[model samples]
Target: MATDNKTSAILHRDTRFVPKKVVGGKGSYLFLEDGTKFLDSTGGAAVSCLGHGNEQVNQMIKDQMDQVSYCHSAFFGTQVAEDLAQLLVDSTGGKLSKLFVVSSGSEAVEAALKLARQYFLELPTPQSQRTKFIARLPSYHGTTLGALGLGGHVQRREPFEPLLSRNTSHVSPCYAYRGKRDGESDADYVVRLAAELEAEFQRLGPETVCAFVAEPVVGAALGCVPAVPGYFRAMKDVCEKHGALFILDEIMSGMGRCGTLHAWEQEDVIPDIQTIGKGLGGGYAPVSGILIGDSIVQTMDKGTGVFRHGQTYQGHPVSCAAALAVQKTIQEQSLLDNVREMGAYLESQLKQRFENHPHVGDIRGKGLFWGLEFVKDKATKEPFDSEVRLSSLIQGKGLEPEYSVSLYGCSGTVDGIKGDHLVLAPPFVVSKTEIDLLVDTLEKVLKDVFASL
Candidate 1:
């Protein structure tokens, strides 16, 4: 069992005071120590797609435990792991090169980085091959050292700047709302962004860059923003021309969150290495992994006959069982269909309620994920003063009385330190009534906070 230390020794992300203790969870709500239930709008950073107390997922875990909780992969293989891998490969149309599992998104990312480097090494381009990683500014991959370096969240990287990788660099994210010129067409804006990526590749010498990493739908960073039309295809073309790998961090945007099994399917491009998590196990277990493209995997299979990387928990039996159940549930129930239907309803509801609101700057998202940008002036799209902590205030307001909402606060949408946004990612199984409640509560909370401002 874990032992409790002194409050100061806890070393929480925020040290001002203690956070509320969660005692239990049930049906899309989290119960706190004092018995207050929060609506769970953010689904714990968009992880709990199945929501709290999903019986099927829980039963799958229990069954796996009853059979065999774990066994070292070095000595033996588990059917659960093999089946899950087969499921994933089948879902991707048998095009995936390999599936490397890990315990978390960060681990998945670390593996991908090492795998990319290894791929180059095996191809004899180990020396002249690209060694640099190019990701967009304001994007986040994960929190570990390698993943952290790949991420561009300034605030998160500030304290760890000295320890981060110098091999990684940032470029502009294809955020049309903020990135588009005053009168630039969407197509022109995509071209401009593509040009920026090309320039970066040229600047770094294309052969020296290992991969171009991006979140197909910018998650956590720019608030579920999908690229403008032709943006991804153009970027993929550029990467192909440069002989660089395209790695996508879909930890928050894939697995039907964007109305497709893989978000890349909607973008008309395929990543050489795709990192997925959160929805993979639907928060039933801690699991994330990399789905490799045919070329990279084939190169390694033929050259080394073994991957040079792995984790202790790689292909964990219990985690794989839970994830397999989650995947099966999504497929058997056709949850992606619901994601599209309910996503349209949620988008329409948000637009109807906030599109013309005085202080609401933007409402954007895909499927069940969404974000609301708060601003002081709608005409100028000037965000609220960060000092006011408008996002926090709205979040606090929503977690009152009977409704509990987790608002994901984001800054730097306007710059690296000035804007604020609230992300809402409810469960995939959410009903119209529940969505209405979320919309109503969010509307009320925003209004109350705006009035206070």
Candidate 2:
């Protein structure tokens, strides 16, 4: 493990902690410069869905490079870009009718927020009064200011809280593990959460609300937490009642990350505005996008006939080609089929290994994305002291030579500063054998970590 690289020139994510140098990567493993092979269980914060150095996606990037690498979206659009948008629309079966491509998950979320605001401005009556947004607490949208404003992740938003949008408010997240009362049934808990959302709308003056944005599955901020059944439908109904848009930020959980093209597919409601990335380009290129519903498309068509948003690198030909090829590869190879099958296997293995473990308080997730929440006192569900930095310690241990594995460790699951959890989201193409190795290595890592603590 490499740390405090005073001699290095690069300013990394954690300046004080320069991680091990990865020389190469393939399928579900990464090769470090020291000749150690690490099982990429979390896919580098769940970004490398297809794993590293996929040849078909790499070839598509090369082919697009030969043609035209970058072109400003203001002047012209490439056929590859057009085709990628069409593919996304088609994949939605016309439920979502248009696309606004961007370079990253944050950009996609920024685009979504802009589109929601503009969509309102373009409506027949032009509801300029609709200026407020409501998102779920403990949810993560992205890191850009606008996206960050919408996110309720306290730790990520702490420094930027002063700059965040006051118009965006947060409601209780549908986190049954923590929110559900001891004797509450799932349905009753959902109803209470829905009522809380409704109350937030009424308090905000329903006419002034623009949208209710949320993640179908909570990602890093809360560890792969999926909403309870019928929870989204209920929340969407409240939005419809208030004449507010129902937006879903699927940037970290979409593009087949949740065993479906869109995470909302599993739920009954399709979002009026959807943001996607991560698996969209499968780490081949930088890409993310906003999918628009017919109502918003019609509004824009009738009003400005244009979306009042533009980015220098939006819809780059090379990026679109890479995303399209990655998507096609997922379809052609039927990787999502493996996702479903191996998801069950991964879930079973995680539960079998962690369910009875003293520190593991909760096991949650859907598809291949799973998280194990650790507790200092299992019966009380008390978190380890944040000072101990349990999650960070677990993550750092994972990178050690003895562990030689990668897992996503996160804290503050209980109020953005109290609980701790770790996630395992392998590539869609991962096999049962790889899943076994990942879980086994993680179990070993946990043993060593807890013993030290």
Winner by lDDT = 2
Per-residue CA lDDT of model 2 for 1-453, tens digit only, reads: 886679678988878778778899999888988899888888887888898889889898999999999989999999999999999999999999988888999999888888888988998889999999999888888899998999888898999898988989999999988899999999999999999998999898999999999999999988999999999999999999988999998888889988998999999799999998988998888899999999999989999988888899988899999999999999899988888899999999999988999999999998989989999999998999889999999999988898888878998898888889998889998988899888888889899999999
Task: Give lDDT per model, in order.
Answer: 0.85, 0.90
Superposed model 1: Cα runs more than 4 Å off: 1-10, 124-129
* lDDT (Cα, tens digit) per residue for candidate 1, span 2-60: 12334446777655645667898887788888778778877888898878888888898
Candidate 1 residue 265 C-alpha distance from true site, Å: 1.1
The residue ranges of model 2 lying beyond 4 angstroms of the native Cα positions read: none
What's model 2's lDDT at 263?
A: 92
Model 2 local distance difference test score: 0.90
Worst-scoring 10-residue span by lDDT in model 1: 1-10
TM-scores vs. true structure, each candidate: 0.95, 0.98
